[model samples]
Target chain A: MRELQLSLNQTQKVRLQRALEKLESLSSKANSNASVTVADSIPVNYEDGLLKGHGTSEFNGEVVATVCGIVERVNKLVYVRALRARYKPEVGDIIVGRVIEVAPKRWRVEINYSHDAVLMLSSMNLPDGIQRRRTALDELNMRSIFEENDVICAEVRGFQHDGLHLQARSQKYGKLGRGQLLTVPPYLVKRRKQHFHHLENYGIDLIIGCNGFIWVGEHVQVTDDMVVDQVNKSEQDDAKPDENSISPEDQGKNYTRQETRENICRAANAIRVLSTLGFNITVEVITETVDLSTSINVAIHEMLGSEFYVLVAEKESVRRSMTKKK
Target chain B: MEYVSPEGLRLDGRRPMEMRQIRAEIGVVAKAAGSALFEMGNTKVIAAVYGPREVQNRSQQLNDSALVRCEYTMANFSTGDRMRKPKGDRRSTEISLVIRQTMEACIMTHLMPRSQIDIFVQVLQADGGTRSACINAASLALADAGIPMRDLVTSCSAGYLNSTPLLDLNYIEDSAGGADVTLGILPKLDKVTLLQMDAKLSVETFENVMQLAIEGCKAVATYIREVLLENTKQLEYRRGI
Candidate 1:
């Protein structure tokens, strides 16, 4: 066998690490540890507060910038580290916002921090899958699509003189009709991804707002199949209910295990898209997740067989489906 | 310049083996990925915890385990004579190394490699025993950050002066010219993680001073524990769960 390299036990490693930390610190003050910027820095500054800085330029966060020099309304960069910030959108950043106005052709969303998020009219259900200018028919269906006083999850499209554009093109990202909103110091949320499985395990949904507010909740129940099934199971336990003997309610309860599984699978899918896009229990963005998922009174073994979350279909028209009545 | 009095009492009117007040607050830096601040007498320190994020520094990443990085910095305003550089100096480097080693014993680093957990300790003020205070602060901050650790690391320093051993030496005792020993211990495990001495003491007297320092550390741990509990309760209560 080849000779193995000497390995460090825990104690030795600790000692080594300490020495290294000293070295790293020395290097850093010497301006050598040239990395550590935000996007991931504590995260709170970007998450909640409306960003205010010198004109048009977005604070570049690709690397952490030290105060090389300081003055009112502006600062100078002396040394730059990695993990810097840049303008234009990166994927997976939460933006807080509300609906400003709507038309058959398009709906405009107001993102608090960077720029307004726009929902183009033609983006919905087009053959080419590309939205163009709005039409009269879209005008008629506009309110049917969206109205005032609606808060939503939208992806940042791009930047323009008009402002930052937004799209709620996916079924997962849409109008949050119901749920309480929760706010926290943004950095904690960033650090949370450390475990990488908290969202998946907990079976929750989340919507991160760039303005630092969060919308979170369990999924909304689409149908009461579990409730209906439970009643049927209990009836069966009491007596053998033949087709004729069973009531109308009992008859509707007969969802095959596969069909029942499909329904739950759909909800779980919805939870994933929401959670994956940076939504978690940190917000009051609840809908049907809790009611339907919790309504799943199935046995533990059966639950295990089911997927953790039923992902929602990613689509631009998804948010348009939510009506004012909700 | 007497730290231990003729009556066997220390400068603060206690016995020669006495510790100054120790106070701590854990998880205080909400913006930091994790943090805690500890105060030993007039020596106050703020320790911030960050990372386990995307790993940078190719040469630094390890295949088998995570690396612990500590930076012990002194604020410009901390000492009677201002420090021009808060970090990146020999003295700070040595202290930082000691803290990192002492803390690593308790941390479960293999859980997160390629990622870094940066513990930065800034001494806001120094009355005495800055190193011991820094170690205690880092430990609480690590625990507050929810980092896995075997036990809390607590430290205290003792010195022999005028025939009596003193616990928790203040600046006066430390600079007064005597034998000084600082010990970092995992109180529950009864393990000594870091030990260093700067002056000399007789064999029997050294033992006495060491024992006094260990006791002082035990007391500091109690104070740290209370502060941590109070801080956790405050955070939990704010969450209103």
Candidate 2:
């Protein structure tokens, strides 16, 4: 019932409930009592010299949880992993965020964190691919690079005194366009080795941000030739006044084919259904969902219908069971 | 009027020490970080918590702790009279301050510095003891948001009518011109965060009424803990390993 606000018929409701119950049963029984609410004492062997970590505090000489979460213990360290909380950034996390403000020499991005992350202009590679000091001219043209409200993919640079800082030095980490942005609870997104995925068959790109901002868009290859061409084009413009404001390459990239657009929507809808069903989202599951929808001939929009939600829930239960068997 | 029958039953057919039926639902507001709807008999309240995020006002940002803000409102149709009331009236503002102070005391604000947390509670049905209902709803919402807190806070109201101390006073009993006491406490820590009393009562009678309210709070706390634990288990199982 939490965020599963679907209008399902009686039969569909019964099916969904059954699927969810199966999922519950499939979960490991070892940690059934591991879940603790606020102020609940986390039983531990105090004689072992345990160190209290986040989401825990001392109360009456006993370790009490300060948040509602699962108790996690690692050797001498004891902590609680909170669910449904805001994104807690760690170094080297790939995140997608929207530019909230174009501050002086930096762009404040709303990355679903406690504070807007700061993406300094110096941290990112300029459009021209030059490795030189940032001049005043670069500051004036900051909007051209990342305008306000632009969705960008960057890495979490270590936090400074000001706040959390981000860097986008790689070509793959930059502004994203012609796509849909979906926001889910940060806890649902597990950090993995690969966050970026390019589905060759669908010709679409999927970015699973650690901060829970997902990007589903037309695939754009990150090649050095495009950077060289941009540098040459800028030189040409300086020598002779440009006849057309928009370049042919820019136009081609901006115009997404109908098939690719549909693929983007399909992938985005798949994520929406999975997140609502509270399933752990991964590339394998997303692709499987997409394949399931297409094989069944469900329209892109219908992927969000009540019937599909039930199907996905059932499919996930079956898939999880199969994995357990392995 | 005979508020309590000689047989010890109140008008609503409940004993003087018995509380109304309490119900709670989490994640009622889909958009909020944390939300809950709490009901105490006929009094219903919805609470939504947003934040532990960037402080909206730069000047108000705290260097060593998070700023907690609260707003309390009553729907025009919440009461029986259906009177249109202006926003931020004197009574509402006072109640807001009281709720904010009570919540701030339990929330571990120092853990989230330079951020602001906003708690919004609205009364859908104002039967009686709206203040206590709002406090309880806000506490649930905060816990749902995963905000760090020293302990879960629960509140309840008690009033003296016909020399009998009643728990969880309803609208009729609340307006009976008798002494009404609203108590908020961190049930796990066993510390009082808020206590408000209107009208006058003798020392002995005040103690009796306060004792009844404390017992009511402990009962509410047990129910809240059960709700939270159930919700946590649901979320955990759904997001299986």
Best by TM-score: 2
Q: Which digits, one per residue and each the tens of the lDDT, describe model 1 over residues B55-159?
A: 456688776577788888898899998759834788989998999889888776775555577899999998889999999888877756655455678999988
Tens-place lDDT digits, model 2, residues B1-241: 8899999999999999999999999999988999999999999999999999888889998999999999999999999999998997999999999999999999999999999999999999999999999999999999999999999999999999999999999999999888899999998899999999999999999999999999999999999999999898889989996
Model 1 chain B worst lDDT window (10 residues): B232-241
Clashing pairs in 2: none
Model 1 misplaced regions, further than 4 Å: A1-326
Poorly placed runs, candidate 2 (over 4 Å): A1-3, A225-227, A230-250
* Residue B67 in candidate 2, Cα distance off native in Å: 0.2
- DockQ of each candidate relative to the true complex: 0.02, 0.78
lDDT (0 to 1) per candidate: 0.56, 0.93
TM, every model: 0.49, 0.97
